[model samples]
Target: MKGFKEFLLRGNVVELAVAVVIGAAFTNLVNTFVKGVINPIVGAFGTKDLASYTSCLKGPCETGPAGEVTSGVLILWGSVLSAALQFLITALVVYFVLIVPMNRMAARRKSLAEEAVEAEAKEVKLLTEIRDALVAPLR
Candidate 1:
């Protein structure tokens, strides 16, 4: 019971849980954006919509007698393009909005903390010296 409580209260575990939830939510948002926005843009380019684009091979392919696409790179590339675009956007957002700013803020806070500790130590040393001087006179 105690171990379970400790595990539940651990800061790292809580942070990890939040991160996982956020990651899952972010992926869903990206999927929606890609499906709704990016796919149309890609579709506007080469041939039909990139989301539905497929190769029409000549022999033993789609154009052949009573043949279908029978699988091609483009078939898989639809989702790939969507995922790639989302990944690029996510990377850019993380770099600019989250990672860079977080790093700078952490650095600033660390310097401030170090400075405070150093000042406190200096004050303590000065107080100790003054106490020793007073005791010496008394001796």
Candidate 2:
């Protein structure tokens, strides 16, 4: 029980849980965008809904009133295209908004840490020189 509590409180676990929740929400937002904005834009060329776009794999592919495949094989290329678009958009946004910024921040922190180390080394060297000079004169 104690270990379980500790595990739940661990930084990685908490971060992962938050990420899952946020990812789910983000997926919905991207889906909505694709359906509402992208589909309509593409609709200007053909159908308004991307999912409705299909290629008949077999002869005389038919759909029911609700668009369910009633007979024959159908390659739902439009749905695939829509999913691909959503994936691309999600990847682009995550890369630019999250990964890029985090990488920049990490680089900045590394540079600052290196600078501090260099400064400390210089200070130590200067102090050593001063101590050596004073001691040599006394000896």
For model 2, residues 1-139, the per-residue Cα lDDT tens digits are: 9999999999999999999999999999999999899999999999999988888876899889997889999998999999999999999999999999999999999999999999999999999999999899788
RMSD of 2: 1.7
lDDT of 1 by residue, 1-139 (tens): 9999999999999999999999899888877777777776666775435555444344433333564445432244655666678899888877998999999999999999999999999999999999999899888
Please tell me which predicted candidate would have the highest TM-score against the true structure: 2
* lDDT, residue 38, candidate 1: 72
lDDT, candidate 1, at 59: 42
**Candidate 1 error regions (>4 Å):** 1-17, 43-48, 54-60, 63-68, 71-75, 132-139
Question: What are the Cα lDDT values of the candidates?
Answer: 0.76, 0.94
TM-score of predicted structure 2: 0.90
